[model samples]
Target: MSDSQLAKLPTSGMRRWQLTPKIRLTSVQATLADDLELRGEGDAHLSLVIMCEGAGWFRLNRQAIQHYCADSFWLSCASGRCQGYDFFPRHHFYHLLIVDFSPELLTLVEECGLRVPGDEPKVFSAALAEPLKAAMLEIQQGWNEASPLAALHLESLALNALWLALGQLQTQQEARPQPTASRLPSRERKRLIAARDVIRQQASEPLSIEEMARTAGLSLMAFKRGFRAMFGITPWNYVIECRLKLAQNLLEESALPLSDIALRCGFAHASHLTRFFQRQYGQPPGRYRSSCQQVRMAG
Candidate 1:
């Protein structure tokens, strides 16, 4: 939002409601009059925002994205050093829910392997699907209800919403076809390192074969062949393996929820993590966590 746009917002009737229900969930529900704007910047917490009612436009850092009601976005604190966003309403009224994940949750998400498919600090969903919408609604209700332990409900709701959003993104990813390997060029170690770094940075986002090849300074075929030959695995498999290892470490070391561990590790949900962990370690992540705890107690 520009300075002129910010000045045009109604001085009155734009109310900001905030609730710190739990250490992990910070909820901000706001209502703004048309042409009004909200601007903020921060690091240290991941944010999940929803334009729950009415249309709005927002810019996160340099990228401008518009949203309608139910449109959702997640912003990671680790990216861009610091993250910023400007929000302005297009309709007569705009309502939004902004949920910030605490540093602990963010760390858990990373450890559990919650990889999103983009380098951009903010990842947007054009519109949330039914599952995500329901979760959002439940959180909203929990936030509105003045009851003891409402924070607990909101915390669960936030995790559920996060999982749904991740699952939706995962579905979209699975629907897209993977790149086929092409003709190979001469192998180089530097290219392999460059490609590996790119994958690590973008593990949370979708894997882009073209981007990897370009970063590695190799042709598509050459990148594929060289990456596989050097790493003993294809680029995609290597990414998954790296994430799974991180998940294993979190499962053993942290008492964070499994769903959180799933997000951190880049898996869509706990079930997805379970399948992969079971395949690799002969037990699910929950079981692994339990076993580790048992061994610790025995020792």
Candidate 2:
């Protein structure tokens, strides 16, 4: 958000109300035989509910009680007034990611190959929830696994997670029309741009395969195959190679210790730094430093 815009946000007891650059998320666990009423105006591409305990009614009107177990439900609505009560999930903790976005933003997600045809929201179970949770968790655990993790990897995993959820939604209702390969214009170029931006910003952080896929705006399999074809190396390998190259430059020029150098270069520690350096340069960092010293002497 722009500085001025951020300043407009009420800081007074609204700790729960926060915003990410592109998303806003909220959660609640209320127990009441009472019916809840919601009257508001907002637009979003998707709203997800991961119920851990308890059950409640869901609908614009208190018309239906979606008997939700330990399952996930997605309510895909663009905008206008939406209401529901006990719409309350029966679970230990009701987790949710209510994505508030413009129609244009939703189109951007669609362009990124996220939403399947006729994709909507409804309650789902382990068969459906596990993969989405797994993908999301993978994104978290591997946030910095550049060679192992990249933005594309995160995006892909997120898509897969949503896809699994959507697939379940399909079974609940009629399937949405499947988007054809043609629907998404080849976005490899945009993907590459996103990758460059992400890599440049967090050169020291690892990028997951899923993140790379997301960056490339492609599915996991498609992103892998496409990234390799475009870059002449797998995305994961390319990321490692890129970080290693940066490390070498810093090691040769900076006065930082090997431990600091490793951390700065994205390695977990000095040892990781040495291992990759030796593998790529045919010598450990100590030797490489000595060699560089010799070169400087000759110069």
Candidate 3:
């Protein structure tokens, strides 16, 4: 159906917000008197829908799926078939954030080695994980920020949400055995572990790669290669990962200011911490802390 036709659907209420030419974000808040059935247009696009607050059932094809508040669903709208949702009457309102993108967006995701699943248009029920929830909230809040940055933030958050969505699918499968890669020499391995331990222990203090190398008893180049072989990530990335994870745990468990958290996590300053935190998790430290706290309180 066209936009105008969709707006006239016999639902309680619906609204669509256009973010870009081919990208649309929608909000649906409906209080139904009966099972409200709605159908999709079967457009060739991708969609990420978050059930912010609601209880509803969606029937796509022959499958009936239930959704709760905080649940998410990813839709691949390439099939040219009608998709439907059934929302029951509720005293409280049901809210949804629907992010729709053109088929071209998948090209970008595929180039990044993160392909959204499903060939035909389908809705896979998702429970928005903590990190993804942060991204969604940031995108929502970004709407209030100034021009270019708001667009940029939405783009980043969309990609981050896609990555997390794919990751969630990966986690649903059972584990399988895989061929093991060759291991580093026993002594070299010990040295690498020792180096990692040193980094972990001194993450809150100023520590150098040279210090880590000396502790590992290897030259800098060798240390880098060996560490990558052992850890599957660069030594620098590993150091940042350690510090960030520490900072993340502290943020979740404590009520510390950014400056204090930065100092405790070995960052040069709160701004420095904010820069890397946003790079690593797509949000600043404060936003991440708030998202985590909200999740904690809800749980």
Predicted model with the maximum TM-score: 1
Across 97-179, the per-residue lDDT of candidate 3 in tens digits comes to: 66777666653332222222243344555666777667666766676565877776676777677777666754542122221
Models, CA RMSD each: 8.8, 14.3, 15.8
TM-scores of the models, in the order given: 0.56, 0.38, 0.47
TM-score of 1: 0.56
Tens digit of lDDT per residue, candidate 2, span 36-74? Answer: 333333223354444434444444333345555544555
Quantify all predictions' global Cα lDDT against the true fold: 0.60, 0.50, 0.64
Question: Residue 272 CA error for candidate 3 (Å)?
Answer: 32
Ranking the candidates on lDDT from highest down gives 3, 1, 2
Worst 10 residues of 1 by lDDT: 109-118
Point out where model 3 deviates above 4 Å: 1-15, 28-35, 63-70, 76-81, 107-119, 174-299
- Candidate 2's C-alpha runs over 4 A off are 1-186
Candidate order by decreasing TM-score: 1, 3, 2
Q: Pick the candidate with the highest lDDT.
A: 3
Is 1 or 2 the stronger prediction by TM-score? 1
Give the lDDT of residue 164 in candidate 3. 75
Of 1 and 2, the candidate ahead on lDDT is 1
